[model samples]
Target: MENRGAKPENVEIGLGKESFGVTNLQDHNIHTEPELGLDIMRHSAAHLLAAAVLELWPDAKFGIGPTIRDGFYYDFDLSFSLTPDLLEQIEKKMKELQKQRLPYEQSEVPIDEAIALMEEAGQSYKTELLHDLKTKGTTAVVKGLDDPNVFKTGMETVTLYRLGNFVDLCRGPHMEHSAQTGFFKLTSVSGAYWRGDEKNKQLQRIYGTSFETKADLKEYLARKEEAKKRDHRCLGEELKIFTFSEEIGAGLPLWLPNGTIIRHELEKLAMEEERKDGYQRVATPHLTKADLYYRSGHLPYYREDMYEPINIEGQEYFLKPMNCPHHHHIYSAEPRSYRDLPVRLAEYGTVYRFEQSGSLNGILRTRGFVQNDAHIYCTEDQAKDEFLRVMQLHERFYRLFGIKNFYMRLSLPDMDRLNKFVDDSESWTKALKIIKAAMEESGLPYVEAAGEAAFYGPKVDFQIESVMGTEYTMSTNQLDFLAAKRFNLEYVGSDGQKHPVYVIHRAPLGSHERFIAFLLEHYAGKMPVWLAPEQVSIIPIAERNYEYAKKIHDLLFSADVPTAFGGVRVQVNHSNESMQKRIRAATMKKIPYMLVVGDREQESGSVSVRTRSGVDLKSMPVEAFLERITKELKTRQDLPVE
Candidate 1:
């Protein structure tokens, strides 16, 4: 049984009123039927997990166990610490419980009676939560709230899921029995604070995912294995692309020589592309006055992610966490005419944000990173076309990199939750319509996310699910009329009247680091010819043929094909090692091509080509081989046969 919320409607009026809030509360009724098959199975599996845990650890106190995207996690307060071995044991016990085919019995209980039962069972955590709920008067709030009400005033009766002697406080629509949860795996264990508040006591979080079939579980595990092989951190280390140093801080990555080559290449491509698209590049300081962020409203909503301010001459300055505020200042830098109305400012700017230590996973999520950021200042009439152009750019970049599985997300404000949205509903509605029209005209698949829009305006977020079943927002194209107004950015219209220019904030490739990481996994580290660090490696048969191999390396390197020389001495010991061993070493590096030079080839003024797949081409003229490689590099070919 899937627990779903009400689908939001396209309300006719603008979302401008302060009283306007999120719609579709009726859709998420607990009594409603489930829409997603996997959701119900996963929720039921959580109950099985609780049952297994209770059988093993009789005193284990349970916290919230809910189904999340791709998985479910249950928090437990235990006398003994849980470990990976214990997770395996729990999985074993869960399988046993599944064999029993126990039924899930859901029961509704009053707040007072539930507290007494939990207290009798020595569930201190649940009892404490019950007391806190009563102290905060949540029961009265839930009881008083109506279906259309966005916020509840008092708590209502709570539901509990009972499996034999084990019971958990949950609002669940679980499957009928544990046997219905066909395939499951316990993935990881971590620490999580109660209620997501850092001040609260941390609880042990066990994360596991469930599926409807063993085949589905196998496929999921296979994808995870593929993801592991393609992990950017592992690839980066093996390729000597980048590294992190203790001295350089936790979130900062130090790019090595080969890694810098790829980084600079990507930046060069972005600079030329954006320049051709009529963007004027500009550089900004890494740190700026705190007032700048305050004016941009980032201080009000996102200050927690920002670093502590530095006091410079009694004035506070902060390392910028975003490039928009600085670019806004650039827009306000000088007086502008109507002809300069569509001013596009672009930057490969690096910004800093304080990500939680647990959240940081290599360069994918870093504290300091560069963004392929650009802001287009245009008239309101041009907003639609401008947004479409940004979307086009995103498509062009992704297409060039062969990224096909992605969708656009139209994020709009939830007017019902007025506190979560920016003040003006009319502007949001207008911007939403413009973005929606642009997306529709472009023939792109998109879904609207209520309450997910930026504070200043609505946005279209490009989303992709990774091999690990984790979803990531890859790129964004946002429409911002409010930021223009807030920054007082204006241009004289044809009628000689000052009008605020609309802003289209777009980033196609996102950040170089993140894009490369995704590409690394997408291609499984076998990068396309043009992007590979070492496209070709020339291997000499013996020490005697080193000179000829050097000549070939120089020829390939001069042609701008990234090539390296591997001497026989590096791998050969006397006559014991086979040529196949040396070739396998080169193949392990995922080098696209390997040219094996020997006395026969040197005498013929030609080279023997061994593609990464071990296909050998007889001695060919130097110019002929060079042309083939040059063509492959230019076309960004990945296939060895090509």
Candidate 2:
């Protein structure tokens, strides 16, 4: 598929396939080259994975296998739980099949024949898939919107791929032979619901990665190992940043004291920045009447993510999943004129979403979290400037956090699937044009994505790469043209007529929980001096130096660093453990600086400074040490870890 050792030819990489009585392939193919991409190789790798699984467990009924970002996975209803040892055995089997040079051949037949083939193989999932394809078109059936009663006749031919004795229902342009599947390795396995429905049976999903070359695979594995070490769930506990409790239920994080400090620091920074940007702070209730959500159209569009409603005094109330609708009410509470355009409302509001437990990953995703949210209500003429300002605000925060590798994703609607988005083509067009103009004016790197916009409008989502090269979606700034009409939001223009205003929804800092999670993994627990919960640890060498340590700690605890909201955080370690052990404990907590106070330091009024990275700054006066750390905190600089 990668064409590593083969010449190019017209391979139908873009043309439609003759399958399921479907005439003419769809034009959604974005690529038209014979040089198939790595995704093609990865897709074949999934088939190989399924083939190996079937070899080990003959009765294993497999589900669909798809290519993810850098890898592939196949779901199987196995008779036994999969383990790391089993993964090795399956991998060995895949290599054996590869050596056999089994050719991948495609076959086309009627739907009933395909169904019979799956029935003989005892693949209920594949049989069910065939039934759906027979009744619904390719798109609706794949998305699980099939209606068995509404079957379409006269077009029942389907396609399948065969590898030796293993035949699978697939629309594939796989490698010519199994040997073409280059370097691959099974990474891990997890439980996934059949078709991602929690009500359905849970199946074993095996994950793996493949590359065109061994070196590429090796490099990817190394990066993956680095990510494993920096995983927020593990690092959060090891560093005592945060933890989850069984008593508190799943998908909820209990922020420890150190984690609280990080959240507070982030909140203070956001508040200061928003204040300078002319944003007025506001607060709203956590839950409101269900009628409000119905009015906002969230009930129809986002009901799945919301928790069940609470019946209060014969009325139903729901937890707020977002702050947009509430802020709209705030805007409508009072009359406004042309002079009052661009109403900037900011809040650190806590919102709730019923995220599936299996998808939860520590604080990166949770049930309840506070969002650093804001909405700008401005006139049509000021919408462009307001959007540009929001982009600039995001850049400022990114620069402050040393997030250098990021790009904006322009998300727009798909006209083909208008059911998912607002049925207002005029608004969609205007919103897309305005956001694109703002992005172009800013000269920031960005890429376009289709069918990923909010239900009501287009948006720009920020995708950031951590220092470890792991990328994630960070935050978004959306332009809404429908909400004003939905909420009857209006302002008096200079002509004294009521005119609708545009709304710009933005959450530059996203949520405190997720942002702190990103910051934790991004820094590898070595937070900047300004954000470190315990900035300096005073480790006295002996009992006599305890008093001196306390004095130095009190000095730092009281001194306020410039540009920092609070005083420097310093703790004196008067533990009975050995001096080196105390220093090591402090380092393990990721304290930026450890000040060793002893006989020489007590007499000279100086401290022996050691960094968490084990750098010995030698002996310096206590005042000098204070000045150095103060500068670091004032500048919000990262202490050298290497």
Candidate 3:
């Protein structure tokens, strides 16, 4: 062991103690422990990936390689295209070097020296980045400063990592040695722009994942396979529920007839529940003047998430990205008395948010979505009660969907990081206290997170992890005292004086697009009977039983069960296909039940009931089958079928 040159005196290891205001790193307990420390190892593995690429292809140029949530990726510019077979070659070289356990050595170089080295290597992208840093006010790296031997007019000292003669400029807290990166696999290769700017040249990006043990890697791969089977995009297409077209643009889903049926059912359920909860249904325009956003502070802070304003007769208008401001205007439409202190306004509002193209994944992340949105206008004394009611509503709905593995997230602001939160500190504190109290009274398990609150208030977000081990925000209940003040919303108090009102913004179902997509995966496309697009299917054993099948279809259709008849193509089982083939077709469509009719069943005045799980209920009265389905539909039960 050579000891790696006395550990390089100016290592600069560990998070900045002063910036985080922590005198002792151990006290905060925020050090990169085993899991995150292993991530650093994987990041070093990414560098190894790039090093192998450069060794194999001498002219290859580097872009960036960073560890993501569960994996790492590196972008490269190569003379030849990369394929799966090529990735194996790269992996072979990486393992060869890993076996050597090469030391990752760091070195500081002068500005001109670094530039000349990269230029000779034809790394023009790095040169351009260096020049951009110089244009900014960075004076740490200079052209020719001799005494301190440091770059005085560019990015602070450029750090380079060298492993067995392969060098890369990086800001590293890498693994101590290459051998630490274990149980790694190269997953895929795709094209990406340099630094995510579309105008930049496209580079080939290689994605890989690493774990501390082989078992972890195997578990990750198994979860990935499970997620693939549950992907809503594939399920939606197979079930003929939704489709996307290039002509309709990306992120806009075109719902087929079956999909629309599901959407309408969800809307109906929400509307009924909200009406019972004393909510007043209202509708708002999809677009509003830009001045409206200015009044709500959205124009200045949230404009990036909104589409660019449209100019009309010297006035700017924008498609609404949220429904709160519009609902605020509706609340202010007339003078309010103390009796109307807790007015609940609800809407299935459609909104448009500008999501990055790379972020869009079917309906889960879309440009346009409809939120099951509502806002409660209440007095300060009613804030806690209102929040509690919202939480109860959320729990009730989750129970309906059999979602039990979720918890509350109390999102509060970082008082020390003022820029990360709204300027009104007192209001934020009050809102945070009220939400915390509500969560406690509701008796729900919750975890607090700093810097996760909304700009207008503190919030309690409901989070659920998907089958793929990815966390998603299911719904949110936010308390706001600032929005009321900003919009000048006030009501007469008991003393007959006008006082600012409090607001609670809630979305129990979040966005319809995202929730449906989650349910599609969570249930593996086997939707609950009530939510199933095609609840029942009618099949005739032969063409001779066609009349009986049509009668059964009409009867079920009249009973409000979604049923359709399978025609001659599905009826004729004489060809290569068997009865199992027909049943498999219905199962693949996720039809909750199938009614198989033949002369025997027709003469007996009963139907052969077959459930989605391949259970053959020999012969049951049509009335009995309808009764069971009706009960399940009305109660919205997650029934265990035979």
Candidate 4:
């Protein structure tokens, strides 16, 4: 048992290391304390749920029950489809079990005895799990690892959690007893394939939320409701930002005109920032030879996520999955001295990955997207300064976007998994020191995650909070000391000898698709004026003033206030609809400016300017209106909105 509060103390009980048991709980130390001991409470509630399900369906084979952000879920193999009424019954049963004050008893059972107990209880899944563990060293060639609970590791003993009449295969540091699980709700039930493989049998997955107190749960539920209202998928379509087509493909989005405008503006802004920081822009092909990836050491580590190779001219080519390899080739394509030591290359490069269909979420997760990718090559001494600069750049980005809630995560390597990476002890130590010094120098609040680093290097992942209070990774900065040697890229040092350059890989905006999706939800479709699809919507009071509206549109369009989609995002609503209706339409579209031209204003060579927030700025001269908009666009200021 652990302390029951937010940010728990020593909740994780590690069995051992250097040949650790491969259960999900084994790694829970990294994620043990989450928001007021909620993880422990939710985790305990999962056991309560399992106990409840087993009571109703005696033969139900239970699967893993992991605690999620707001709640937890447990998969069960049952005889019938689940319904809401049955969920209520399960919740009711769980409440009854809680009244019994059951204690979760952890026991170490011998492997053979564990298998015999599961087999006798008709838990075929558990038996298969142990059987796989016993044959883990035999290379039995599993058709597919289709069970999330199945860890094919031959542990000396199986740790089981017993709660009343129900026994589950679990590595538990659960609550002391059932009272800790009092405030919980069984949220929903859905069918999920075992282990997320479509070919595997579908199991009923029950989802629920648990908090230490009812007030906390209520606040969380309210946030959940708000999240639904601000979901990017809904906001995107309603605001004409982006849409999907089944005929086009899954995990691939065809950016709508409005969405294209936002992306173009973002690219333009990022380019300007990078240019100011001495970054040279370059473009690379969408496809490259597979040999390049093999040389870059990406094939062995990332081949599963990469698209299959394309056969061209009897050579295997692949869709470029990452930009670093190509950038490294660029660095090696020329000869240089220490003067070019701090070479920075940037691009809005498009990359492809074969994301599983189920894992894809609108624009947030897609197969094809463009990244604000950059690579910096500098001397070993300049590496820390460059890393600090990257961190400063990240802070600049967040400030510009009004993102106040975020922290950096320093991802370090796991010594136990050294074989999976390029294991140069000296290089790893040097790189870790450089990054750690930079982090300390930068004086930024950060957290550390072990075993989260890339195969090539450690990295800093920028986790930004969405408007809904959800923290998500918005950017990543990595320190790579091996890519230079791997690509044979070298620059002559001041000592007049060839030296391996330090590589710093960064993506401040992450990707065009995901960032735009985030902005949509973050601003609630009230995009900043510079990045809004349509900066101004011209609405005439009646048909008689349509000509004046057209003239105003022409003038603004002619000014061409730096918009995406290759043109000014100005529209003249010449329809016969009432001016109020047209204004309403423009407001709903999240247009930053609505210029309503009527007879008197048209004759006065002026127009009534109304902001998207419904503030009427009365009538102003056409020149002054244009200047106001031009200044807003130039400064890229976020205007106040409704």
For each candidate in turn, the TM-score is 0.76, 0.79, 0.80, 0.77
TM-score ranking from best candidate downward = 3, 2, 4, 1
Model 4: per-residue Cα lDDT over 390-413, one tens digit each: 888888888889898878877666
Q: Which residue pairs clash in candidate 4?
A: 5-36, 5-37, 6-36
User: How does residue 502 of candidate 1 score in lDDT?
Assistant: 88
Stronger candidate by lDDT (3 vs 4): 4
Model 1, range 1-642, lDDT digits (tens) per residue?
221112211111112332123222223323233337878888888888888999999988887788886778888887778889999999999999998878888888887888889999998777776665556544222344453422233344567778867887766788888888869999998998876778988889899998777897898778777777887899889877889998888879888876776676677677767887888999999989988777776675556667999999999999988898788889889977788868999998888877787667778877888888888999888888888888877777777776666678776666765445446767777888898889998897788776655455676767654444444566767788777667899988889888888888887877777877776766677766667666666767787877887777666666654333211111211233456776777788777677777898888878787777667776798788888877765554554573
User: Model 4 Cα displacement at 255 (Å)?
Assistant: 1.4
- Give all candidate RMSDs, comma-separated: 7.0, 8.4, 8.9, 7.2
Candidate 2 lDDT over 1-642, as tens digits, reads 110101100000111111101111111222223235688888888888888878878999988898876688999998899989999999999999988888889999998999898998899999988887777634232433355533355348888999867888888889888888889999999999898888999999999989999999999899888778887888899888888999999988998988888888888788888998889999999989999888876675557668999999999999988888899999999999989888999999888887788767788778888888898999988999899989998899899889998888776556665443335777678878888999999888998876544445666777666787656566767787877888899999999999998988888787887788788878988888888888889999999888998899888888877534466788898889998999899999899899999999999999999998899989999889888878887667764543
Looking at model 1, residue 260 earns an lDDT score of 74
Using lDDT, rank the candidates from best to worst. 2, 4, 3, 1
Error of 2 at 117 (Å): 11
Better of 2 and 3 by lDDT: 2
Instruction: Name the lDDT value of residue 605 in candidate 4.
Output: 98
At residue 418, what lDDT does model 4 achieve? 54
lDDT of 4: 0.79
Alpha carbon lDDT of each predicted model = 0.73, 0.79, 0.74, 0.79
The number of residue pairs in model 4 that clash at the backbone is: 3
